[model samples]
Target: MEQASRTVRGQGMSSIKEVVSSWSDVARLLRGGDSGALVPVVIPRDNRGLRWTTLVWFGLWALISGFMLLRGAWGPIAMVVAILSFILAALWWWRSSIVEIEEGTVGVLTKFGAISGPGLAPGRHYLWHPWARVAYVVDVTTEIPYAAPVLSSPTHENVPLKSIEFFLRFRIVDAIRFVQTIGAGNFDLVLSNSVQDAIRQRSRQVRTERAYDLRGSDVKDMQELLNRQLTRYGVQIMGCNIPDVQLPDQYREHLATRERVAKELVAYEKEWELTRKRRIDTLLMEIERSKKIRDAKIVEVKASLNKARKDVAQMLEERETEAQAIRYEIETQARTNLVAAQGEAKAQEQLATAYRDNRAVLGYELARRRLDVGANLAENAPRPVIVHTDAGSADNSALSTLLMAQLLPQIQAGAASRSRPALRQQPQPTGDEVAQAAGSAAQRAVQAVRGRQK
Candidate 1:
């Protein structure tokens, strides 16, 4: 019996050695020829123990199987129960390694105690449970808002300003950094604090009225400032908004009162301007009327002056005509007088010249005048007849008278010749005249006789 047992043990040992050699060859084949060859590589697993509950259940199953074997009841079934208990323990440990990352979210991984290569993307992912953990499962797509408290104004140093409500929208950009610094569970609280800090700092630079008016720009500035702070924690700020603002009641009432007073002052100024314009208009109208009156007076004076000048001109013309007529009359009278005086002087000269040239004619004219006077005396004298024949008788007056008559003519001729110095001197007649006178008497008697006889 001992030899038979030894032979069987030798055969079992040889079979066990053959299985070990085959396993070594399979390990060498998996290792490949070189380090750079394309071959499946196994990562080193973390050292982790099974869960206490699994171990306890496995121990309980082993104990049960051992007790069953000691009692010699269904030995193969007890072994199968023990093997199933080990499998149940393995599956229970593997449950933690099975990770399901939801859509739009990523799972950050950590091996042992340090961060691993990259984050796990959405879908089913396996990890070494209890050693490699899903550090953080962050939603990189969804935005989360952080609200801040009311802030004060910088303009009014002591005055409390409006209550400003603001919100910051953010999303996780780096899941690894987010897990390392601000974990997903604490992101809201940390972002809220950062937003409050940004609001407090930015509010100090803006006035209350300006903050209310430019709320959009103010919120945008807060978002940018908050992002600078959150970037360290792997968070990004997407947007910001200031929804409501509330001011103090007292300040609003003060502004309203000031506006009302300004409106009243403007109305008063406008009324004063209107009154001044009316006064200026009245003065302008009076000035225009005075100018018109002055122009009319000037025109009237000019007309009067022109009429006076015309009258003076006419009077001067009439005076000149009368003066010319008087001058002409005086000149005509002077010329006529001159002509009459010249004619009279010329006639006297002619008469004096004729008398000087004919002195005998002048004597003849004087003699003729004396003869005419003697003849007239004789004609008027009375005739007396007386006879005296005695020669020496004193009564011979008749003969003497005849002789005187004959000599009278000769005496007048001699007197006329002596009176004119231009006439020739002549002697008086004596005996011849007496004899001529006696002959002439005798002849007269004979003729008287002859006439009687006849």
Candidate 2:
């Protein structure tokens, strides 16, 4: 839409862009302009004026014509002047016979009030008859703008819009058909009607609430339709659009209120979303903290269990060592007691055998001593001598027990002393001598027995 308006607003015409350059061109376009709009191409002037160089050259041609008319008639000098003037004038007229049209314009020809040959291109041309001339000029290069505002057009909902402005640009393609059929001045009404109808039809298809959608929407279908209608008149719609659409004031106010409510709803939704995200983040942090605490507790429990197992193992080893030591001590004491018992039994048996042997030897020695005493008594008889022992006294029993134990050696010594002197004296003896000696000996034996009994 913006591009269309910019193009339409660019109506910058060139210096020679006068569609009505003269009164003849105006009469041809307004009154009898059906054939074409006419411009002077016969004289071959630019901007409808002669330049300085052309003016100077034209003065020389006037001097030649004057010399041809005023000089004497028959002299050789006059004849030569006439011949030179004729050549110069003929060349000058020949130069003027050539016609020219501008580069962007075309010229149509009409002779004796009838259409002649094809339109002349923009360059040098010559007319075969004096009656032939360029009857009109048509611009073929420029694009002209047309903007028409359709006011209070009815929509599909029967809602009449305030206004819809349509704009377009067009160029003349068939110059002869354009000048003969519909000239530039009359094409204004036809273009306005076409734009109004197209814009109202488009406005009808859109809802009243969506009227602004037409501002920059494509108008390709509408442009094609307009081209179909205006193509016979040699005009082509180069570009077109709906550049403006004005809605009712009451409807605009309603739209503004609806927009404010929609914005408020969007703001509340965003705030609620933020609050939900913050709560989710806090919960996640708490879950991580609890997991760390649980891991710490598990590590502590594992350490305590390992320590208890190590202590129990140490106690079991100490008890086993003590048990082994007690068993070894008991075995050593039992071996010592067994050896001591065997030695004591052997010593008691030896003591009893020695006691029996000594008793038998004492009995044999006493019997032998008794036999010697009897023999000596038989051989030597002594005069009657008596020695007695009282045997009933307790005192005598105790005295006999003591005398046997202490007086045996003393008795043996006394006998031996007495025998020593008898052996030194004579050997033979008489009855009295023998009797005396027998009496002594018997007395001594009685005394010895009495000592024993005492």
Candidate 3:
């Protein structure tokens, strides 16, 4: 009822600016507005942009006046003095107004009804009193912690899920923007929502497999991407990291089986390839060795053939020389035979000539035979035929001597016989005996003479 009476009294005040001239008029306006009922009436009154010195001056003046009245002094005079003291003290305090800013602290102060500065320093400063007031104080050195949310395919193909989480570190860079956009009280909410949004955006572009296969480096990239996007809100993102990734049971089993089969197939193929290459290389080496042996044998045979040819040539030369020597010997033997034949013929002719030259040898041989016979006869005969021949008669004397010799021997014998008878018993030769001896001797003498002459 009291608030209704005040409203009625303030109705005559007309404009809002004029109605709020005193504290009671302001209270009445506040009471008339239903929206301002719950709000204490002191808030608008206290937040009237009043300086600290103004409040102090008002209190000092009130106290001095009360004290003067209690002492029972000149009340009116003391009241005037008290009001002047209060005004002077207010002036002094206004002249001594100070603004303080600390490190990592921002202070915005108003002075003389105009905003002075949002000073970023850590010390005391002065500003004009009465209209000067501290508008805002900011703690510039605060750390922000945040996180990223990610969803991945589950290991089981049947149950793909969204259960992944990460963390981030950030700071407030622009104090003014941070304060204007979202108050410090809502800072955590803003950062969390922004990071989660960025993660979802980035995740949509990636495949489910990629998210499931995320590693430490991938987690780091997520942090960097989030930082860039969240920087516009005066938020300095330090790091965004993923600590864990979750998958469905079925998917994990399938992936493991696939990897196992691939590894086994690769190993088997590699072993087969190695074995085949070794076999081929061994065959090639054997063929090369065989070729080398064949070439060496061929060279050996050629050398042997050359040696054989040389031996045959030597034998042929020896045979040719032997044939020449045999020819020479045969020729020499023929010459020797011819010479021997000629000598034999010459010897035969000489013997023939010697035989032909011996014609008188036969007469000499007959004479020798006769001489031997004569010697034999002489030895056997007595000496009875002695005939002498006259030297002058020569040819005719020989025959005559022969006849006379015969006759004379006969006559001599006859004459001796006749003389002997007379002498007494002398034996005398007979005529017949004498004649026979003379005739034999004469014939021997005649034959000898004729043989000697012939």
State the C-alpha lDDT per candidate.
0.59, 0.62, 0.54
In candidate 1, what are the lDDT values of residues 1-454, reduced to their tens digit? 5346325423211100001122123234223311222111112222234563676587577768767686576666666677777777667677746766666666667777788877888788776556676555555676644455454433335456556666556777887787677564355446555665665666666665454664656466677787888899887889987666555678656656766888888888889888889999999999989999989999999989998888898888889988988888887777656654554454445444444534455456557757755765664354443434677777656778788678776766675556544322433334445345545554555455444433
Tell me which of candidates 2 and 3 scores higher on TM-score.
Answer: 2
What tens digits encode model 3's per-residue C-alpha lDDT throughout 253-347?
67668768878888888888889889989999999999999999999999999999999999999999999899989987776666555554544
**Which portions of model 1 miss their true places by more than 4 Å?**
1-49, 52-73, 94-96, 156-158, 184-190, 208-211, 256-454
- Residue 274 CA displacement from its true place in model 2, Å: 6.8
* Candidate 2 lDDT score relative to the true structure: 0.62
Model 1 lDDT-worst window of ten? 12-21
Screening candidate 1 with a backbone cut-off below 3 angstroms (N, C-alpha, C), the clashing residue pairs are none
Encode model 2's per-residue lDDT on 1-454: one tens digit a residue.
Answer: 5335434533321111125344234323322332232221212112322232354455565556557655554344544555565566556555644666666767777677565776888777876454566666666666655566777887778878877878787777887787678665556556667777887888889998788889989999999999999999888989988888887778667866876787887887788878888888888888888888888888888888877887787777777778877777776566545544444343344334434543454455456545645644553334332324566745556666676757655765676668656745744333455345545554454445444433
